[model samples]
Target: MSTLEQTPIGAPGGAAPAGVIHDIGYQRYTGPRLSRRHVVGALYGHSLRTAFGLGRSAKAKIFPWFIVGVVVVVAAALVAIRAQIGQVVLGYAQFADTMSWLVIFFVAVVAPELVSRDLGSGVLPLYFSRPLRIADYPLAKFAALATAVFLLLGAPQVVMFLGGAFTTDAGWSGVWNEFTDLLPGLGYALLWAVVFGGIGLVVAAITGKRAFAAGGIVAVFLMTTPIVGVLSVLPSTTANQLAGLAAPSSLVQGTGIWLFRDALVTNQEGGMGIGDFGPVYALVTVGLIAGCTAVLLARYRKAARQ
Candidate 1:
């Protein structure tokens, strides 16, 4: 009041007066910054944990573990049958094909959890603000989802292998054969992981709403099946031969028939009619994985910019 009374300030047409400044004593962080690789590794680990709901709420744990339980229970029953009856109802390669629906459901449920929430909460910008490049985030998510799928499919195959090995009358020779078969089975599971993970992540990354993302993923897999049936019934032999390309499940089955005919097909009559276009199936399968991956990268690129 004394200063104001002593001098009148800011009359009309007068210039503005400067305000006082004060230092709050905040320190600058000059510490060593972690590189991009560390950021990516951490993100991958976090995403992988998210896939199985490791640190998530109990409600979040239910669906993934339910799918896992069903798959395991089925595998255990098959192992029991192999031990007791000495007859393999389904071979190693067939196990993946048999579990295709469950794999789809798992991907539908988990992929959205991995990505959509980040999108919904608008945390991607914060993620990009770190040492991570645009590509690192999407690739980390893709790798985590793929590893999770592999574990889901691979664990039960191990159980089946152990059951077969321990129960075989052929002794060590049987164990070796079981080992050999398990390798192809795991490889087939890897293929499943790639196809589903790539496709699912790309779809999930497109939207911020988890429900929409999940529905779109389900539709992507399920809606294509009828097209395959229609193509299979077509009059053209070429259409029938290439019909499996229409759906992801049939596409993987066709690829399996091409690569692991002995494990997937019991007879010429029982197998997919991929015909001489086996190479086509192989090429298309690779294309699906590669194409989905490219799209995933592009998706995040656009997201990062915005």
Candidate 2:
């Protein structure tokens, strides 16, 4: 062997050599780090955009905008109906009730887009690895979804309000009255957003696959609604009153009727039959939101550790 080939590759006698660091000019960031609120706000805004498919591909936007279009068109039609017939066929609260199916569809489509994808992409742990607390991730998402749903329901109501306000025969006073009526409708919409948004996000978070998440969300909403109908028809008075508790839609509507019976229920006979259990409905609404939020936070906490 040659003299060079006879030598060990490392130090003398085949010992390994120590590694040396190669430094190009490198600098550490000395700038101030963003606070938790900024992170929460970012998550909230990004999630809100995702809820409506903003900044996403065209295909991603089609469904959200489609639902938006449908609701807006319906609002326009209601306005036209008012102008031509001089009758309010769909009141503000009723507008939300009329769009319940669309709301369900929107939540089904959107909740999955918000969280399921994060779970599927395996980025939730990465999210939790940062300054974001476990609750922050889900709560921020819930708020975004709730806000999106509020806007979804509110926009049409605004259209309805504008139509009513402009054509009022009583001048500004009538406009003020229309505005007052519309406030409850907006509040009711927020209630819907809270209940629906909370429940939908919980379902979506359970499954990583967006397709499955969406299906489960729809199934949850659709399945429970029939229970209300079945329960309301039963002979027992207690059962009839509590029937609205079965489905989220009825739960929210029951609460609405409780809070604003004069607006939502025209004739006494056509009411939701919640009876004296209206307070129960309101309580359940609060409980359902709290429960979902708790479950969501728990789920993310476990997921973060994993």
Candidate 3:
């Protein structure tokens, strides 16, 4: 009658075969794709909340200002006691160099916490069960740490640059010049952040324990720099980016200094600045970043299944 009279399957009675419930159950179990956008949004919100909470903490609020006050008091005392204090203050213009410390420490220590905690605590599995995907986790974590580092480390350089421009003999035009000059330096810093952040992520994913991951990252990074720094001095072979073992900051800073030196040498051998470093450093920095990202992703694929 109605298609209910199906074709026979080994019988004259022309009956339709029953569907398997196990197949239906299996179909129901298929998971959803992890959404990158969702992960990013969630991580962004989380980071903001954490930052805000830290800002509200009484100890945190007092600690920073206390350090600033101590530095200012010391500077004032130095100025009153010694004429060289003025020179020292002027040399403070090179303060941006100190940002490398925070960049290195934050990348090696803080990034791993953001990455490994969720996975180690089983939160990642719950997140994966939702609309969020596994791939999104690392991307979101990377974005969060990069942004946090920028805000924490880069923002100070920006403020100092502006402060120096306005408060010092450097006028509006000088300020603009300095700002333009900083573009390359900031670009290198950003690339280093990404490279190190990726290394932290890979270490976290593989290690699973936050403390071990963080400590191992810091130790390895610290150990590598000195070794590379010594090796860089060897005759007949200047340390290229490869021997650095993915050390982006050292490579960028070193290369940037070299570019500045080249610029100065070409122009009456003036004092070398960051501008001496050429585009080659920038290119190599980008390559390191991309390479770290690729390794992180490949390692993540394995981590996900585990």
Q: What C-alpha lDDT values do all the predictions have?
A: 0.87, 0.88, 0.54
Per-residue lDDT, model 2, residue 166, is 89
Give the clashing residue pairs of candidate 3, or none.
Answer: 34-133, 259-276, 259-277, 260-275, 260-276, 260-277
In terms of lDDT, the poorest run of 10 residues in model 1 is 1-10
233-298, model 2: which lDDT tens digit per residue? 999999999998999888898899989787788522575778898889999999999999999998
- Per-structure clash totals for the candidates: 0, 0, 6
- What residue runs in model 3 are displaced by over 4 Å at the alpha carbon? 1-39, 48-96, 168-171, 237-248, 258-284
The model with the greater lDDT, 1 or 2, is: 2
By TM-score, highest first, what's the ranking? Answer: 2, 1, 3
lDDT of 1 by residue, 255-289 (tens): 87888877776632574698998899999999999
Candidate 1 stretches with Cα past 4 Å from truth are 1-33
Q: lDDT tens digits, residues 1-306, model 3? A: 123323445655645554322322223555775565756697766754443235356753453344334434543443343343322242221333344555565555565556676666755566665566666666777776666555554544454455445544457787686576556445544544566666666677677787788788777567777776665555624343334433554565545455443222332222222333356566776676677677666666665676
lDDT of 2 at 204: 91
> What TM-score does model 1 achieve against the real structure?
0.88
